[model samples]
Target chain A: MNRKEFIDQLKSSLSRLPQAEINEIIRDQEEYIQDAIQAGRSEENVIASLGDPKTIAASLNATTQIEKAVGATSLKQQAGHTFQAVFAMLALAPFNLIFVLGPFLGFAGLVFGGWVASSSIALSVVAVLIAFLFKFAFASAGIFSFLSMLLFLLGALGAATLALIAMYHISHFFLTSTIRYLRWNLKLAGITKN
Target chain B: MNSQFNKGVIEMCVLALVKQRDYYGYELVESISKRIEISEGTIYPILRRLTQEGYFETYLQESTEGPPRKYYRITTHGKKTAEDSVRDWKNFVTSVDSTIHSQEK
Candidate 1:
């Protein structure tokens, strides 16, 4: 293949990347080809020496996605980057879908489930506290009533605090795992930092 | 060499070369590929990653033959990394060599 066709193939394969990043990668390859040709090499020879465009694009996609995952600041952004990185990694080998997809889905479900459970527990505690306040306002002011109200308030606060701490811990675990998985994916794609 | 092994070595090679003098994309590719068989396309991503990691700085230099070229110069961080990597690689090779030779005997 000639230089243009080679670059066109590489560009099309890397369509998922941001336009600026895609352009930069393409420009590098184009310059390499230009230099090779200027140095008395044939277009075909230069393209051949560069190897397959699809493989090159796959490596580039893996590297870029891994970088994005590492650089993401927020949890939501990190999740997005991790998803993209995992998808890019799975793309490198179609058969990996069978082995990787099931475990990935399970892990995602567990994290989402933990979030839902923690949030619901916290919400329920608040709801109970609100309901108790309304009851205390309507009921007669007795010693037993006051004590019950104090007990309910303390219990609700304690439960809510515990739930929130659980949520924080769960989210932290998810973020750490996501980063580890991305690093594994990069290694699987042969983009190690060595 | 195995591609997996080459991937790591290539990063060190690039760092070591740039530590000696600044090199543009094409020039670096040519210099390394002359000694090691690698996909010339892979070097760009390595350069990009190294630059982002703050191990290298890049600038555009105008070329008389064509458009401006992006030249990469190693940072102090990159020089330190290269020295460490070279040391580790030598130690690894020595250990492996001794092990293999002993087994042959």
Candidate 2:
């Protein structure tokens, strides 16, 4: 196929990426191909270098997670996911603080949040303890006394907070990078065309 | 770092090309290669992905050059995205111009 036809096909395929991921993938390909051609490469040679599409697609997925971890989210998709996660965490923060910081000794609202938070933390700990001590059955902890919800919450708060922070950062980075990448890419493509 | 990274922008380029005029796969690839250095197979995934994402829709047309060739057309959403991204690019370039490129006040 001629180069235009090939790109048309490629463009069609690229549209399938998540709205947030569109630019990150497209600009990279356009630049790579442009550079290769400028260096006097043949069509057959260029195609060969790109390798299998399916394999490339799979590799792209792994990179996306990393992109997310590093504040790589794009501006356009700012409200997409990381924001959602942050909000969700914010909503849960009250619960998390209750168990970890307040530990059931507080106002009714704080105590209520603590109770729920402690229950969740207890469940996680119970699962881990069961997996090790019991016959390696993780879910069996379900049958155990949800009795020590207070202790479980206090114990697990540190781990949960850390996990939440990690999650928050990844989402924030990924969404921002995607937005920025698309913004710049679209502009570059536009300039060359005009 | 890789062609995969360019897939999103490439898709926009494809849509832009078609906005001016429709082209087949081989022709599209040729036109793009003239401007950029990329793997030939690279465009295929971008095409497939764009189609999946609904930016550009496709239909098969009989071709005199070879077998029925697939034709890709940019959808409304695709055009909007391309335009928006282009606008975003201008802001970035202007910033870079003042902050990094420009020396004289």
lDDT top scorer: 1
Q: Please, what are the lDDT tens digits per residue for candidate 2 over residues B5-101?
A: 4545666677778766666666787888677766555465456545555678877676454345567788898888777877776787799788875
Model 1, C-alpha of A160: deviation from truth (Å):
3.5
Which consecutive 10 residues in model 2 chain A have the weakest lDDT in total? A185-194
Deviation of model 2 at B99, angstroms: 4.2
Residue B43 error for model 1, in Å?
A: 1.9
lDDT of 2 by residue, A37-156 (tens): 655887656655565433344334322332342343453244433333332222223333234223212332443465466557656776765545544344345534443643565567
lDDT of 1 at A156: 73
Global CA lDDT computed for model 1? 0.77
Model 1, B1-105: lDDT tens digits are 556677478888888899999999888988988877777766776788788778999888888888678899999999999899899989999999999999999
Candidate 1 off by > 4 Å: A93-102, A141-143, A184-194
lDDT of 1 at A105: 76
Best by DockQ: 1
Q: What DockQ class does candidate 2 belong to?
A: incorrect
Candidate 2 local Cα displacement, residue A169, angstroms: 18
- lDDT by residue (A1-194, candidate 1, tens digit) is 88789989999999999999898888777777888889999988888877778867776776677777677777777777777777766665456445876887788888788778877877877787887778878987887878887797778778778877776677667766766765554444443221
